[model samples]
Target: MNNTLLPAVDTNLVPVYAEIFLLIAASAILLIDLYLKGSRRNVTYYLSLLAVVGCAVLTFGDFNSGATVYTFNGMYVSDPMSNLLKLFTYVAVALTLVYSRQYVTDRGMLSGNLGGEFYVLALFAMLGQMIMISGNSMLSVYLGLELMSLSLYALVALRRDHATSTEAAMKYFILGALASGFMLYGISMIYGATGSLNIPDIAASAASGAADPTILVFGLVFMVSGMAFKLGAAPFHMWAPDVYQGSPTAVTLLLGGAPKLAAFAIVMRLLVEALPSLAYDWQQMLLVLAVLSLAIGNLTAIAQTNLKRMLAYSTIAQMGFVLLGMMAGVVGDDTSNMPAAYSAAMYSSITYVLTTLGSFGIIMMLARAGFEAEQIADFKGLGRRSPWFALVMTVLMFSLAGVPPMMGFMAKWAVLQAVANTGAVWLAVVAVMFSLIGAFYYLRVVKTMWFDEAVDTSPIVTPTDMRVALSLNGVAVVVLGLIPGALLGACLQAIEMTLRS
Candidate 1:
């Protein structure tokens, strides 16, 4: 008898404790929520928040350990970058649930047949984001992307009775599917060229010039295009405005926030980590996309009368800065500046998500039962209505405009500095000019809030928790701007450690 003995597989679940915990917690929450009725739904909300906190606690230990760990047969990784991004993702999800509580309740999104599906879907979406952040292989990244995208699609269409919401969801779903198809085709091409689906193996193959160059370049192009669509960069950003304007404000917040961080993580994974040999090609593409995004996003935002649509365009412009940072990472194979440049990009994404959450939170706060305060005109004389929140809105607008003493300014400065360090002065100059143009629209909102006459003089009633959270959100932006060294240092360390590992 010739018996063949197979080698034992080594499996470590420690690297993915947070993800596993989140998955189990979210599933349990979904089942537990069904038994809760009426106002008891608050129990589900609190449970979801607890799940996020538990995930954060689970992740913090790994992050503090400052060690790179891989598990699942090299298909998953737990690194400084992933840990940091996951922490931020948890914070973003928690804040979204908090700020959205009253808004969703008023819109009937959390009641009746929906029955806490919003919370369940959000937790699931967050789980998907965590997976994406830690994904070490193409297959894992794609799986995580689809999971997150599917959850978001459902969230967008949560208001099944609303025609506009349904339309937006359809657009998002179709475009998202197409983007995923592009990415999958690209992954297949890459696998064909390199004979590997593992990111590090692909990197080695590409670096050694063992991969087929023609097929690899084509795959990179398609993948970058897919990444651009996910980031809402121009030319691929058609669905953003429609979806942002049509979905419930709370849903918009969910869409615009943590997903950006996850998207940034995958961009780093696929482009920088897996295909550094083709940096020049992808850098050129990012440069063009960045310029187009800035020109289109800033110029078009000026014409938008809908606040949500305007913010959507603003998101596009902000992503341009991030792309610029990514593009600046490698200049003619001099990779010394990569960590700094990519860290700047990371900082830009995190700050943008923070500012967006506050902006949307204010929008939701203004919305009452049966009325969506979506129009730009709705902000007229908001200063007279609620001076505190109006001040918060002004701070948020200033930050988005890249005004000094706000986090956005520091983020833009960091990106521009990184670009300049690479001798790309022209790119930095163009970014600044476009930013100047962008400031007009943001300031216009401030003017509307503080200068325009009061159309509705009703008091803005908000839950104490949201009020406190929004205030802290706004304050953090300013404080971070004034002293950005800590966050910037953390980002730099995270990127450096990630690349080293």
Candidate 2:
């Protein structure tokens, strides 16, 4: 009943202005496609790229103090946390376009059907992600999440004539719908209990130092279950492999990257911001999800013959590492250790996105007409035939497997150390053991490329744009792996901003 106690509802919208600009540009792309027709398709690409650069510039200008900036009557927020994630999403999507468009075009996935739809859909997806990042209320989070999910469903089925592509899209749509339902139901329950959807309001209400045990605990479980499925965690990971395998390689690349950052932001916003009083309950739930994800992801990846499917499982395992850091941060008895643990978790997320995108870049490189190159057998003797590609692939696989001197290794070390420091040594131990099991599958890719006999396969023609993009993507992983300080610093800065509030 006390309006004055609620969070402020007026602040500068400058931070999220980039999202607005992107919306305009996306509409322009679609219009251009409709009017100009066939020959001017390339114009859409150029405009999309320009929009991305513009958004990046806006994001750069937006970063400043760690103040919580309410926009649109407390529905949105703009702080260092949201800004950092928005910048990352921008960069990731830009890179995806640069690398993926040429492949999509080459495969006839972009012809005869409003060539700009992909760009438009991508913009909508980015909009959703931006909203999720700055969402101060449950309504905003769900709206943004649905926007992103709907765009992705259409994106996966862009090549509608293909049976596999349609199937993958359908599976994703069904699973996503279920996850959304769970999240919505949980939000309703929370609203019924507290009569509020604003995160800070929920926190303030619970800050009297106690929570309604049953309602809070069940709501937390439902929330976590929904987020786990979104992040492709175990027991909810069945869709990932099939979707990755069946979709076009370009779609798979998008599926594996940027949206993950959105997922992380949503979870942090809901759990840490809204339900701080119920930390102990969520901690145990996350630990179970993490353990199961690590076990299922690692053990199942070894048997996968398809590269896309293997990477899907690998993503599940990586999600476990993210959860491990989150759980450690929450469960740690020493409050002093929380910052470091959370930073580790956030850093792992950034590194995982970069490494996974780069790995998928390689797969996209080998993909050509009538030859999807989805199978690991396709990679046999790749080292002998294409030494440079093999070399890059080797680094990506090693990085994913958490091998030494790579960013993945550093990320794992950071999280596992935090888990150990929290006195969760058993969880840490299990993580390490599964990491080794995960390594075996990554090494198998290496073995096929290097040790196996070279096949007499036909020469695959690669587009110059894709070739250049793949090279940059692949090299970026190794370069970042060698010097992860910048990304790590960004992660720490973002985490500090989020928690210091």
Q: Candidate 2, clashing residue pairs? A: none
Error (Å) of candidate 2 at residue 93 is 1.0
- Whole-structure CA lDDT of model 2: 0.83
User: Worst lDDT window (10 residues) for model 1?
Assistant: 1-10
Tens-place lDDT per residue, model 1, 364-405, is: 989999889999899999998889899999999999999999
lDDT of 2 by residue, 1-501 (tens): 999999876756675788889888888788877765665677877788889888888877766555667777777888777888888788788878877766777777668757678878888898898899889998999899999989999999998889999999999999989999998888888877777899888877766644466786677777888888889999889899999899888788778888888888887889878887777777788889999999999999999999899999999999999998888766534456667777888888888888887788777778766777788988989988888888888988998999977778989998999999888798898999999999999999999999998774666566677677667767877777788788778788878877877
The root-mean-square deviation over C-alpha atoms between each candidate and the true structure, in angstroms, is 1.2, 2.8
Clashes of each: 0, 0
Candidate 1 residue runs with Cα over 4 Å from true position: 1-4
Q: State the C-alpha lDDT per candidate.
A: 0.94, 0.83
Leading candidate by TM-score: 1
Model 2 weakest lDDT span, ten residues long: 329-338
